[model samples]
Target chain A: METVMLDTGISERGDMQKSRVKVGIKKLDLFYSDFQALKDVNMDIEEKKVTALIGPSGCGKSTFLRCINRMNDLIPGCKVTGDILIDGTDIYKENIDVAYLRKEVGMVFQKPNPFELSVFDNIAYGPRTHGLRDKKKLEIIVERSLRHAALWDEVKDRLNKTAMGLSGGQQQRLCIARVLAVEPSIVLMDEPTSALDPISTGKIEDLIAALKNDYTIIIVTHNMQQAARVSDYTAFFLLGDMIEMGPTTRVFQLPGDKRTEDYITGRFG
Target chain B: MTANDRWSSKEMILQYRARQKRRQAIAYAFMYLAAAFAVATMLAIIGFIFTKGISEISWEFLTSDVHDAGREGGILPIIINTLYLVGLGLLFAAPLSVLAAIYMTEYSKQGILIKIIRYFTSNLAGIPSIIFGLFGFMFFAKILGWSWSLLSGSATIAIVILPTLIRTSEEAILTVPAGYKEGSLALGATKWQTMVKVVIPTASPGIINGIILGMGRIVGETAALVFTLGSGTDIASSLMSSARSLSLHLFILANEGISTSKAYATATVLIVIVLILNLIAGWFGKRINRYKDAR
Candidate 1:
């Protein structure tokens, strides 16, 4: 696996282990005005790995994924404290370019929201906004991204057609393709298959597994089976706290925390 | 307490239901009558205009320049002026209202300031077109020294329709799903880029519909244009040239008793133009729906 390092000269820590952390979040706290959403969240997300954040509704699993890309900033009165280091650089730092940060950390929303444009244009929108104007290059990016999302064959003939004509599953895949076109190092899927059918969910799960070889993926899912099947690492969140995080098999089979076990075993969620 | 009372209770329930059904029937009849009344009024006016003016309309009457105080010749110049006024008014108003709507919907937070702006927008809509005419006369014509010209008239109509334009456009922009903006932003697009690339395009159909409505106002406008645009019968040679629209021409001809037939003819042409505008708007709406439904 290629070690995707976002920042250089971070190897000088004398006795520290050389962990290739793609995202290093430490004691992170988020507040919507005064109501705290995340409390003391600390996690080390490895490079080019599939990590799943699983919890019940309002457990802050989705919030944590959004925090990685600083998307919570869009919400009024939402505030974050502590450090979220992507490739060893603090994303909350004053000098951090949010747009650039987002470029590196692309997000796929739960709902499939293809833009009101042609399939080709929808895929090209990010690259075009980022100043990739060459028609030939945009075409190549669109084709490659669609293929990567496993949607090229289904949509190749209708690339020029409006994206709204696609089925729910195809639209979701197209959205994944849109995210891929920007060439991000990290991909955040916020319940990406929550709105999809069972078959579509399986397809997205397969795509996520394939994607982890190149892009670091952080998925938020309510489906325990999906987390177990697709993720290498699974982190169980409960009430804004990360209760347990470990190898997917270990976390599901032998959870360290009582709450994690309860939640995973369908005792309570 | 008695068997007779029990029978009467059942009878009363049936009577009540029958009465309710009768009232509903009456209400439906009343609604239909009201709709029919409105349609009849419109038809009567259209029929009158067609009967009086259809005979007056000829190729020469349409193409040739008007003479003898618009009694003898064509209203070509008047038609041309009306188009210029509507075109210029839309050109200025569409961008302003769209941008204002974008600002309010996308950028402005919900607060007292937004409330005040909204209040003012409603108030602006309520203000009569005549008031807009006076203001335009004072500001654009006299104050700005533009005088009774196409510029002044267009500017006046722009203000007259601006409130409606802004209100409709704001509603349109608000209807665009927040998901689209979030999707764009997630892809590293800036707020402005998201608004332009996703928000605006999605809202454009509504915005265009609003513009069409505003154009309808501009086309039918006579009171506002009367003062801001001096009653010049010739097609505008320049932006500063004074001109009279079809509605204004119709008004003058009818009021002065120049030619009732000519006035009716002018009204007919104005109605046709409005119908054509609506048709064009409908066509554009279909095109917009193609993209909208897919997304």
Candidate 2:
């Protein structure tokens, strides 16, 4: 069944000849103090597609994900020397507004972290931050984002209840709904399902599959099956280098690099 | 041979277990006795104050103003003056310390400057109240030309409690999970907006706890209020007018030997006020927690 889908994806890539790139990262080198984390990385992420970054622990996949939105600036003694562009605009430019860039590119963390607030407030927080003051407008945005994330029905009646009261899966879905509230063009997930149960993980994977139609998604995952299941394109990382990146079927079934083959074959990590 | 060896080993294990249980029992008894001693000491002090002061706490003694060096009348004016000091001190200290804490935890870089500021805060907490009184008298009453007045006293108390409030609030802000801050920032909220909306709201209960603790210190203060507020035993009509706090009034009465019972009564009132403040603080903390839960 997945092979059939992969054949369709190949024809789809050919049919959609434009293949517009949403994010262009070039010579992206990141250093935490004197220790380099990402070394001369480059990639062109297609618009409205799911790109999975799979690697072992401390392989710098998460670091690369954060660089896309300049979230790395929050860390002390961390520096970046490279160019990252979103839709042909240089994000690392001095004049770029980081807050605005983040609005354009949203992130979901490994742990489900909702503010100590009501579910409604958790969704409305981004819209409210951007100056949506009308109560009716906020309410509409909250409902719309929840519905888009497929969480509206479970929490529709208890919008005013605290978000922390929700189950772990529900909380993670709420976090996704929160990101959707801002209506960003791209979404970043840093192993968002690592902390969830298998059932919850499947739900989020389905949600990611649905989200890729309108939003470009870059996800970091340790689960190889998940990368093969959800992502249209997969990039394998080994010690801060992109070993191989291609269609998910090719990366899993016919890996190009020895390290990628070894890692995928359960030989060694 | 194996069966005989197993029997001897089992017997030794049982003996060891019995000795361990005896030691555990002894430890529990000693811990209970220590706790009892501490609680008993506090109860005894409260008992002594209640016995010595209960007779002097009549309606007349509560309602009327002090007369003849607090020997014949109520300490109403002194009580009112202390309230003014506490109100003003909190008005200044709460905002300043909370903002300072926010800056330290949220905005400031972790470097030598932060280390120095923290060192100074701990040192400030250690300074004796009498030294604070001297500083307030020289700087606020003399140099600033405010004289011995409510303004001077309130300002002194505010500074005296600022370090403690800041330290408590900093810890509170730090306790907020890093994930929440990162989550807010990822939603495109600016640093200030994140602090105000998410960080401050979560830390508020702890911040309020800190403020109330600072209030307790200010209310019980005697030496500082005596030097800066002038022990006037009169209601302060204006910010600059001389006044006396309950603690200072009690101190003056006891020192003069004019009315030891009146002094005890004033002490009792101070204790009651502190007790009420603590109850209110606890209730407020629970309400804040419930509000944060939102369920």
Candidate 3:
């Protein structure tokens, strides 16, 4: 296996002996104009593990997921005052290039947003944007990423067809493949299966399980069963506050916070 | 608690239903009448023009040079001049208008300035073509000293179509799904890359439709060209050389009573060109719909 060196002169090693934390958030606060979207969020996400952020609507779980790749920067009047460190590097620092940071921290949106392009081109879009132009190299990346996304067999014969022709499930997987082609270390999924059918949602959950062996995965999900089934660690958020976070089993079985217990027991959001 | 008790009586309910049906029928009748009137007006104008002008059209009428102030010869020079002027105008206007729309939509903050710009752009579209001609005369012809030349005419036409292009392009850009842009950006593509790769391509069919519509405007324009483009009958030798467009030639032939037959022939050619442009625009409009359906 090859190691990827970040621009901060830190080589990311796959060794288990090193510090397990892949992302560190400290004193994080986010405001959209007058509304505070996230309040004092502090968490450490482990390397090569699945972390599920379970919350109700407008709970800021999706907002926090977007913060990982600085996707919130696209919103006007959005302000963030905090430290978000990925591999010991503060991503929001003045010297950090946002585009480069986003390349290393890919995101998957809730809806299936495949480009209105060929299935092959959809996978190749990220690699091409990152300046990979060699045809054979792109083909290899496309195939490997699709296989990793568990969509290669279904779409291999129609790679040249427009991705808009794919089923909703296939399109979502194609979106995942597109993110994988960039080879980001951390994958942020914002309710990726919320728009999918049950069967497709199951496939995505399975893919997420397989993916955590190679990438640090952070998922924002409204489905509690999904969170309990797929995540190694579960964080419960409500009304812009993270109420509880612990191992998935402990959080579900013996939650430390009353809110977490209430939320899990279907008492109230 | 029976359904009939809530309605008071079945007789009253039948009367109410009859009144509602009558109201719907009246509304649909009015709508149908308005639509029919609009289609009839368009067809009438086209039918009148074809009947009066189509007979005068010939291969020579489209291919030969003008003589005796368009009384005796073909309108080939005028046709070429029209194409040259409109093409140059589009070349100048398309990029400027598209860029302005992009800046307004993507880069500029949503505030009073954008509102004012949008206000003026839409207002500019409603202004009469004669006003544009007068402005073109003052700006491009007299002040710039490019008096009555093809260059002046092209520049004038560019302004004439700027609002149309800008508004349509802006609308097209807006119609692109936010998901497409977000998807691209999420994949680490910069805003510029997302716009170039996703938004612009998605919006292009609409933009092209706008251009075709603008071309139709330029093709039909006479007053705007009369002041900026000189009524020279000869083929334009360069950008600086004075020349007349097909519309100008038709106007001169009919207005001055030079030759009604020649005017009709020129009108026929101009109408044909506009019809072709409209067909192309319609095709592009369908393509835009198809793209929307695909997404």
Candidate 4:
């Protein structure tokens, strides 16, 4: 029973201190012009758990996750139908403020999307936009966010420097802290460590586990081992359909669907 | 392995080698001849202008007023008039062109009409300056009832340079990265805020280059001003009154047959002003290019 809360002693890490809202998609379908990207995806992302969306390339996992935060709205031809609710409130409501919705549902893109700003400015940007204008308050938020992402010790002294001056892994973590500064309930990471070296990738993986305590974490990754290492639950997608969804231990060891089994075993994406 | 195969075909190979050498010599000779002709033509023109013009140029010539009667005569009044036109012309043209360019690059949707309009603006660069002068005379001087005054001439010159300024500024604004705008807007800043804060500042170098180049054309222009600015070298108080520009003075003194010496003096002064304008433009162009290319 202790193993339920501990993934090799990971619960000692305080992985769920604040993130407790119900998160998921219900019968979600998406299309780009005439081409359908996702079809009827119904899954529940457990509160305060790191859920991994695993699939081959073009499997629509990224599309489904983007729909949650409405990042897909930026694309002119993309259309989303069905419900993506955070805390049981349909976010796509007519009067829902897209700007305010973005603040609640923070995102980290595939690439490190740190602005062409200094390291401090990058983290300070989100809080400033939310109207945290006091210089001392901005300083404190930047410190905490960077520390949460485990980057403050190395970057604190040189926070005045450009974000682009950082290494690739560092930049990705900087982006994560940037999103975290606004204090959102849910964090969507789309292949966040896909571009990092092994050591940097390990650091980000640990940070993701550490972050689940304060925020709901949903990561879209192609690495099967990554899905097993960091997540409590895993959803397997193939060619735009949710093939299987279950506890991480159960999904990889005993997949309910043939496609999930094949994907986990590297028989197909 | 055989000697004949090792050595290859001697007669045919020799003939081909000879032909290749002849072709190379012909190409090199043609390139040098063309270069020589270009340098010679340029030097010849400059030499002819300076031979008659430079001797007539003096400080007194630039400081005095024009006279067909018992009055002081100097090229200074005309010199001042030329500078006035270029300054006033650019003041009107630069902002108007920048706004027009921003509309084309930022607001317009790139339909058939937009494409046609872009094409027409570029084609204006190919139009003769004389035609621009005619429009200036007919529109500003005649229709606007301003007479052959500084206002009409300068306004006409401004119209002549508008297309150039717009095209250059359009190119500058269009080259701004989509990432800059997106990054700013995603932070809750409005679209206009992003443009004013990040986009326009970054593209400023290109816009400045356009304005400088457009002003150069205004400084050197003569055909357009002759019909619009009048043939007298008298300084005026207001844009509503007739005044003589340097280009117009040069033409009149050179053609009047009574004072061709003063004409040469005025022509030399005009060239110096043009050179100054061109140098400033070149310097500005270099700075803008550096800003755009910075990492």
Candidate 5:
């Protein structure tokens, strides 16, 4: 199988060598029973940068995002082939602990899914699951994570209250905080702002911009403008195929493929 | 044509509305009558039992041991035996049922074997209690040689309620939102950790409801206990010692024509215990809903 290297001149710019490949996918194929959801996809995600996967519904962009953390393993009769390497280590290989991999690759779902626990416990859940027991240590971690997700001030006083009582946006940020408590190196967001209002979405986009300085972030979005605003590199997928991927500016301003240009310029999805 | 001509006149619309209201009134009356009849029957039973037995209940009557085969003294020994039997039965059945339900719902694949297991579990619940009694007598009492003791009776009651417990528990577990499990799993929690931390806590109210229902069955159970548990009026000293449950005492008193009042009193006590369990289940259910609705 041919490995499609979509590398561009952007990687050759000054200080580019410092930005290493955080994830490398080669000839990846995914199927749910008979239906292929992702086909021969390949990309190298950079460290400490935001990579946005933008496509219309049923375009396999979300499928590709889930593939990064192997979340597709939960689905019945799902199959995967080829490799998904994080930091040059093949995550698909046998003996790789999925729990540990997920600890390194935390995910925030589209809908706000806070557990039926207090705000503090919700953020502390990941650390506790990983065997953090000291109360003071958990308190510190929870506060730091909530601060990182930009939800600290709103929920600081109500940390002992049930997380379900928080507003939709607060709940989403709390989920992000929960993931951050695990201290993952990579953060996967599956349309994190799709369910939020404009203001909440703006807050999340700002947080993403701030987050990329520390963690490798991969986000899937349907909004084209959002892709342009937050992502450093943009990958457009259609019908299980990655049609084009490059620097976000180049992909939006001067797309190489006609399909990419058509999709980005408001042609039929 | 004008819009006024196309629509019904005000008088005509009023007439149609009146006719619809009359029809709805008739339907509502019938539905209300059906509900009233169900409540009336339940109240009638409780009224009769309390009226007949309330005068018989007193400190002396409740505290004294059974004398002259349940005709002359309080049912203290029988009450103790009832508690012991039901408690022991629940201890044996509840954890096992919950574990089985979790395995069936969370771990097992939806396949032919699981389908068969579910089929048998549901069918087992519908089986007559008398059949269970016969099985208990044969298996626990005779074959196992734990004959006619509280141990045998409690074990029999456990089997009798196991199917009900497992079915309700499985249904409760199924009602947990899929997102909770997914969220937990995405956080690097293992499947078992997700189940323990997220799934079980969310489903606990439903599980408690199932257990309470099982407790009612065990408390009211008489036919099954009769064959496995001997009708001894004395308080049981050990697992091997023969004992009599409240339902069994009620059965013997009424059946043998020894004391109808005593039987009514025993029935009253059993009803009160079941009522308490039901109230607890309701409280837990409401608390869970309130927590959910807080959002």
Candidate 6:
């Protein structure tokens, strides 16, 4: 049993054994208008590993993910004071270009949210905005993105059709494909499969497993089993506090913190 | 009354049931009568106007802009003036109102200022067209010193419909789903880019419907233009010049009891133009909606 319990959260894949931090947050506090949302929080997301942020409702997993891409700046009166560094660059610096940051940091939301445009165009929007409009070039980029997301075969024949016409699973895959089109370094998913059926959820889980080979993936999921199954590193949050963060297996098997243990054992959220 | 009631009897139940049926039939008849009254009134008016005036619709009358149809003017210049005033008024009102509406719905914060603006806009919609005319005459014609010119008249007329245009355009913008904006912005597109490329296109059907309704209101206007526009049949100078509209022309003819024949003909033309516009709006609105649904 002890031999089976690997300390660094690796059970199947050798990639999760060790890695340096990709994004580090230090003493971060967030406010929406005047209401405090996230308290002082410090954590590190590992490079080239799937990190699952698990918590009860309103525990700020979504907010924490949003901070990576400066998505909070879009909300009025949403203020944050902290240091969030991506690859040693202080993303919070005043001179940081959000546009370029967004290019590097991509996000997939809870809903599929394929654009009203055609499947190809929806995937092409990011590349086009970055000024890659040569027709043949765009086509190649679209194909590469779809292939990376594992959606190319299903949609290759119908790329000109509207993205809205796709099934739920297909649309979610399309959304993931959309993010891939931008060639981001990190992919943030906020309950990407929460709206999906079990089969769709399984497909996304498979996609996530494949995706970590290329991009650092951070997923905020309420499903504990999902976190256990897909994540290499799992951080358990309670009431906006990081209760325990370690190898996913350790956190689930023998949580150090009583609160984390209680939560994992189903005593309380 | 229930059977448990001591006051109920066999004969009384039958009478009551008959009365209830009669009452229901009377209610239904009342609705039918109201509908029929409206139709009958419209038909009567149409019958009277066409019977008395259709025979008098002549090319000479349409080609000429005679101030007194009994004397000399044909409607050519007056009709032209009406067209000029409408085109100019829409040009002035359409862009400003659409922009204002977009700002209110898309960009402006939903705070005190937005609430106040919405309040005034609704109030302005209720204000009588004559008051607008007076305001135009005093401010545009007199203050701006574009006195008795088509430009002042059209400007005033444009002001009159400004509230209507703004309110309708606001409704159009509001009808568009917030999801479209969210989806676009989340894709790293700027707010302005999202608005122009996605939001506006989705709301175009509703916005055009609003514009068409406002245009109809402008064409049928009489009391507003009477004071704002100079009472002349001459061709209007540019947008800045004074002008006469079809409704004003009809009002003058009907009141003065001369060339009453041309009034009905012009009225028919005005009705036809409105119907054509409404048809075109409906067609475009339907086409756009179908395209969106297909997506």
DockQ, in order, for the candidates? 0.66, 0.68, 0.67, 0.22, 0.72, 0.29
Candidate 4: interface RMSD equals 3.2
Ordered by TM-score, highest first, the candidates read 2, 5, 3, 1, 6, 4
Residue A262 in model 3: shift from native, Å? 0.6
List, residue by residue over A182-239, the lDDT tens digit for candidate 5.
Answer: 9999999999999999999999999998998899999999988888888888999999
Clashing pairs in 4: A15-A212, A15-A213, A16-A213, A17-A213, B61-B75, B62-B76, B64-B74, B65-B73, B65-B74
Candidate ranking under DockQ, highest first, comes to 5, 2, 3, 1, 6, 4
**TM-score (chain B) for model 4?**
0.85
What 10-residue stretch in candidate 6 chain A is worst by lDDT? A1-10
Which consecutive 10 residues in model 6 chain B have the weakest lDDT in total? B64-73
**How big is the RMSD of model 3?**
5.6
Best by DockQ: 5
Q: What is the TM-score of chain B alone in each candidate?
A: 0.90, 0.93, 0.93, 0.85, 0.94, 0.84
lDDT tens digits, residues B93-133, model 6? 99999999999987888899999999999999889888888
* TM-score of chain A, predicted model 6, versus the true chain A, to 2 decimals: 0.93
What interface RMSD does candidate 1 have? 1.1
Candidate 5 reference-contact recovery: 0.82
Q: How would you class the docking of model 2?
A: medium
Global CA lDDT of candidate 1, please? 0.89
Query: Which residue ranges in model 3 land beyond 4 Å of their true spot?
Result: A1-19, B1-6
Positional deviation of A139 in candidate 1, in angstroms? 2.0
Please write out the lDDT profile of model 2 over residues A1-269, one tens digit for every residue.
12212431643246347678899989989999998999889898989989999989999999999999889999998999988989999999999999999999999999999998999999999999998999999999999999999999999999999888999899999999999999999999999999999999999999999999899999999988888889988898888888778878778777889888888877776
Clash totals in order? 3, 0, 0, 9, 0, 13
* lDDT of model 4 at position B68: 71
The docking quality of candidate 1, as DockQ, is 0.66
